[model samples]
Target chain A: MKQDPDKSRMNFPNRALKWLVILMVVFLVIEIPLLISHARHAYFKIDGWFAFYAILGFLACPALTFLARGLGVLVRRDESTFGNEDDKTLPEDLDEQLR
Target chain B: MNNFADFPPALILLLGALLVPFLKPSWRSVYVILLPLATLFYVLQLKTGTGSQFNLFTFTEEPLEFLRVDKLSKAFGIIFSLNAVAAFIYAFYYKKSTQHVAALFYIGGAIGTVFAGDLLTMYVFWESMAVSSTFVILARNTEQAKGAAFRYIMIHLVGGLLLLAGVILTIARQDGSIAFNGFDFETANHAGTWLILIGILVNCGAPPLSSWLPDSYPAASVTGGLILSAYTTKTAVYTLLRGYPGWEPLIWIGCAMAVYGVIYALMESDIRRILAYAIINQVGFMVCAAGVGTHDAISGATAAAFCHILYKSLLWMTTGVVLYRLGKSNLCDLGGLHRTMPVTTVFFIIGCLSMALPGTCGFTSKNIIIHAIEHEHLFWPWLLLEISAVGIFLAVAIRLPYFLFFGKDKGLTPQDAPSAMLGGMALLGFFCLFFGFAPGTLYDLLPHEIDYHPYSIAKVTIVLQWILATGITFIFLKKWLTPKPGISLDFDWFYRKGAVQFYRAADTTLNGANALAKRTFIDGFVKWTCNFFESGASRSTAWLMTPIWMLQGHNAEEIDSLQQSIFKRSKRGAFQIGITAFCAVILLGLLSIIFLLE
Candidate 1:
């Protein structure tokens, strides 16, 4: 069997990368509130900075999730990624010219 | 206002694109050529120096504004139309009519962009270009093209969405309607500005979000690759000049793209991809010029943009011609073609000069930008540009020809390029020479005064020395730079592999608990409801049916049977006891609910 890199198990280096992504997300989330505070100080002291921090906090989890996915060295097991592969749907007669 | 002014020529060409696909085979080629030509003449007519604005009702409540004909816009519109004609001529017999139609619409959308007087109109044309151009990539008819087109569309649509947000926010923060000539950035820090910046940067191939381009562009069909090279990013450079010039961050971003693209191009073996990365590097020069924002800087930026489209398209067209004739585009699979494909080789050499070879179109225009940076004393951008100059020689200028044509002969012979391809190349090659020799013509067209000359002895000497030193480096290290079989990963690894693992890990941690809890909770509730209904129905039926059975059996002879039934009641007492027990259990449940209510 060809050892597909996408499906291969993570070696130590791969594991380390996932951990790094997690840590970065954590660090970003923790500093976000403080960063918002600092930005307000530099400009005008505005209340919306708090809402901004909250919004970032809400987004951080998903961002980290996708970031980790982007860093992974495994192939997706799900078949849905290729869409409908069974039909071999060439573009009908119109499809001939497009192809 | 005249109807000529009301319908911009680009829009008319765009509307005409739909009909191109339906035309007869004989008419297709002529239609493709004439539409852009007529459209070009129409845009030339708009040169009377008039601007119009209109609001449109689609994504927003206000009518979308369209601005027409100005100096800054005319430069881009005229050249874009010219590139369309050249591309159509090159693609005449190569790609299908469908792709030709798509390319026309794509070019039209790009032309619409330069004439747009407002941000909203620019964005509409911006997205229209994105959607239309994507079909060019998808025309390759490979599984890879499907994924590539998807990613390509994803990035541009994201750019479009951000642009919409930026335009809206900027309008809300301002007191007057948009005038699209040049940006006045003091008022641009509105919500729309960030949206707009992100939108434009996405198209400009800025980092962290830049992988979609290299990931997809090389996968396009041969003729498709030539069409793919021109509009998208340059439109972004145009938009940036209109909306966000002088933002200091753009300087660093431009420098980053220049170096990053050069490094990646050095690692790629695919010729089209190398050319694609070269596009990023060349755009970097203009972007940095935009960052400087002086009259000289803007002129340099504008000139660099003009030269870039011609040279970049030339390079892609050269490669596309070679691939079309030879049937392969990867450098590893190509070699010794200079013997047979002399026309392509000659054109490729001329195209290389325009990419910053001394005394070519690039040297004339690029020196002004590099000099503008030096005159401004921006040390970092200047140093990076110098390093990138060396890197460009290794990555593209020398590397492209060396591996593709002069490499260890790969035992393949391809015929000479077709006349259409040759004609396209000859036009670009001629311009490369003409512009290099007489740069004043290009310089005079710029929006600012031309005070700088690129042919001065000292500057030419410096550039020549850099090229010499780099060529010497290449001669010594040529063995190390040879193409090898390997695929290096880029930032896209996060989405390709990283995202899957992240999802799997989350599923792994929760799957067992989620399944167990759900099964137990649902199954137990279902069993309890089934048993309660079964016992209650049995008890209720027995109580109602017993008396009815006795009455129905009570005929004259049934009287005797009824008396016997009365006598049998004592024996049936045990059966009644069982029925009574069931009824008591059901009544107790009802009484408990009643008691709680009370």
Candidate 2:
């Protein structure tokens, strides 16, 4: 079963991801005409631009991700010093149980 | 004031909670539920005017407005009391009397702070909230919690001290007119006002102090965490709206908080702590709105705070349920709970949507703040708020739920949360959608009448686009965004590790000085005096006896030898009793002769 899951993981671009990409495309298409009306209520000139918020949103998460990752040097620390917080709660053979 | 009708509604919860420990569980549960329910009704029906005034200070003509009822205070009071009821339901089965009482005090303190007409009353309730909530953190009963609770109280105590100093200074300067209002520029620029702002900002989880919320809240008991997530920071937001509206510095501060919260929350691992950080992000919107300080902006801040409490508490309740069942809160340890805890899963999604997607209270309330920012033409803040909003969606609405519920199934199978928890979540979840669909219901509760309709097609579509775009990005970046089994460092480092270092340095420096003092005074000067006294008797006796022996023509060498022997013996405390007694007699006889002459 583990090998089967690993083999599946080796496969590129699963069905769920493919479906998500398709959904994004559809959403972008639907957002286009609405953008005209959205632009009318725009505060800045950029709001009238093509999918400004969508473009902003597209990069925003990744930007934040990279930014956080860069700052991870400052933020993250290894748990090894404390050694296995989950072990305190989990059964002793939890790894075996999983396998 | 004499009539029961005019009694402070907050006291209803505060005094009513005192009887909890004495009551049996069944009665206690019912009583806890009824107390908040009664307060909720009372606050909702209260007219917009100050009453329950008392002249605590004879020097000042103004009496403290104990029950200051207005649109802003009433709105907060209503939600606080309502959440109190829901929290009691959630805690009904917790069975810890201390947790229940602490939760009540926390809620009452929040409500009192909301309705306080003056800085003094507000500070009292503010401190009460601070202290009681510390107990809630202690309710977790883990060593990590004990440490976190200590740090939590330490930060809040500092904040409280700042607030107290500011209140006293401001009140004293104003001839003891203790009424709370937005600080004007002359007042705002001063040391006292700045201290007050810093104090309130500390509680708001602004920079350098932002880590306290996440550090502490996750360490609280499940229900206590929910109660905590609902109250502390939101009260500070309310106070900001009341006192520091239009302070231009707040705009920058709020934006910093907005982005800071998102980035840190995204980095967090413990699901409850993740939600805890998200609370700061949500409060950041309100804080920013308070900075915007227009009529609509204040409304936006107030509305955001109100909606935020419901949705955020619902989120906490859902996560609380997860934490309760699994005995863990980290995402690395939790997954596929959607299958077993379907109701909780659904509620969790509602909470996520309420935070990000359209047609939820998150959409409605957040839009109001964004709308205020847009109308005010604040470009940079608007940009940061937008990006932060998307980041929030990705982190909480998308990342958190996907991993905890829908991700790969773990081998572990924990049962669903108890019905009481589901009931609490459902209460808030219903409102999350209710207000989203009909924002007019919420808009009417704002401090000022707002013509803002949050469900514009443009707003809805933009939120939808961000959701889809962010959702796609999350899928692609899943591996990168997945948290490792570690905690992110934050400013709490100052007190956590730095305080230990501080204590060590202090210990070394202070004790080093103490040791030096001991050596210089006791050993060097005092010890010499001790030795002088110890040998003085024998030395004096030898001197006296030698003089007398010389008068009798005894040999000088013999007298000198006797003096040396006496000195040596006395140094070791080996002086003969006879010689000492003889010396005392001779000294007495000499003193008598001197006295007779006198």
Candidate 3:
């Protein structure tokens, strides 16, 4: 059966999962050395903002979650815009009501 | 050393490239090719010395500084200009006047960036590249091109804003002299620093915000992807070298980008996306090298950056040629074309080798970086880089060509690529092999001495063994590692999915707000006033206004009358009116109260 182009492209969720993993790695990687570097540079009077940035970096996860939920609603536009006749494109194996 | 004031005017001539839009299309191509050549010759003429600078133009309130021409900037400038020349030659046959104009300005911006003596100038040129390069992407005239280019521009523009803010803060704090200096990072105002890093990272394809490259590059026309791949990331590496060389977090960030890109490239079916991931991986090595920040490490970083510009561009060009001829770029849709396109096959194989295949340019340069890690004994980055090696082998060395040209045939019989495209690939491939055979020119371009030898017997043997082991491992585990169907995810999903989700959620919330704004405002005020008058009004008033009471009322007038009666009886509205009356009484009574209290 030919795959629906819309469903094929909706490979959107898969990319989201991958991005989540990559970002998790990026966040941790960027932080570890920053913390260590901050620890090493103790003699130099550390500004309060580095600590603030560190906190913000850690907080980006929750922020990203809220942001993601927000964006999902925008990307998933209403399905009916394409057309009204669902029966035309329905597969042979499918029940008519499922369409 | 030439006098600081007597330096070359090459950038000025190139900067006039703002005029290409006014020229004819035929004239545009010549202008594009000639402008970079002109800029290159002029950059070559700059006098070498400390404190050598040129005042180019003035911004709205600042001097547009250029011609700094330090050793660090010189290497980058030369490489950037060389990239422009090669990219132009490859793009010479491209008929789009906008691409030519955009390419020229993009090159100008890169040159202006490298030579700029101050932060403001760097930023001005930085933004120019953003605008011009975006047009280059849009010139592809496809829906994907339009979308990807828009995302690309938006990311860079955000970066530019951050960089501009950083520059403004740095200058303001330092009393307006735009001399470059290392930040204290702790005591220094880091708002600017973080903004700058973000700005640069967006270009560098850092994680969490790095989806632009893989999302966009594959969607470009053949030659367009080649030029696209070269500039943005390398400019970012250049920015880090100039601004924040030894920031240790970058080492780990670079290592992650390296490994992360390789993982995604494994799942990518598009040839250009694979190459785009490879670009991230290559830049990861350099970023890690720069993070290490030793003189030798920096040299390795410089050499890696230089070689990457050569080899990665070559790889993309090869992939571009394949895509151009076949009319499709999906790995699953490609195979068995080596029979017809032998020259392209050779060029592609060489490009794969240069992707760190043994005895290729990637071998020499990547080894130098790994050796620096060994020298420093940085175990974690070293280990991740080593593991990443296997992933790279799987993605580029085995999977890329294997699926595209040697796997089960997709029955595609597209003719051999146009000679022009093949010529470009051959030229780039020749450079890869030539540089691999002789690493001297690359070595000479490094800012520091090359005490570490890349071609030693022990190093070569070790590199060869590793490559051989990876190759063998890939063959045995090819099924597990190489899936024919399915695209893997990367950092870009944030922009792709996260951005969409956030926008949707925001859209819904905003829509809800728009729908309920007046109700919320009125209800909030009424509720606050009801609270304010609680002493005067009985609790029954509050209960009656509740929805249950309103439902019990059964008629609209009854609920409205009940609410209006409550408002009339409540003292809350009269409090404001009576306050002024009380204040007047207080003034009249103050004299008596003072006398009475006394």
Chain A TM-scores in order:
0.30, 0.48, 0.33
User: Which 10 successive residues of model 3 chain B have the least lDDT summed?
Assistant: B1-10
Candidate 1, residue B8: Cα displacement in angstroms equals 1.4
Two-way DockQ contest, 2 vs 3, winner: 2
In terms of TM-score, which candidate is strongest?
Answer: 2
Ranking by TM-score: 2, 1, 3
Return the lDDT, model 3, position B517. 75
lDDT of 1 by residue, B129-200 (tens): 999889887776677777788878987887888888877777666544554545566655556687788888
Steric clash pairs (candidate 2): none
In candidate 1 the C-alpha lDDT for residue B93 amounts to 70
For every candidate, what is the interface RMSD in angstroms? 18.4, 4.8, 16.2
lDDT by residue (tens digit), candidate 3, B268-311: 66687778888888788888887887777777877778778887
Per-residue error for B297 in candidate 1, Å, reads 1.2
> Which regions in candidate 2 have their CA more than 4 angstroms from the true location?
A1-24, A35-39, A79-99, B1-5, B186-188, B536-598
Better of 1 and 2 by TM-score: 2
Q: Model 2: per-residue lDDT, tens digit, B92-209?
A: 7766578778888888999999988888889999999999999988876767677779889989999999999999888877777887888875555788888899999999999887
lDDT, model 2, position B562: 81
Q: What's the lDDT for candidate 3?
A: 0.68
Candidate 2 lands at a TM-score of 0.88
Q: Candidate 3, DockQ to 2 decimals?
A: 0.02
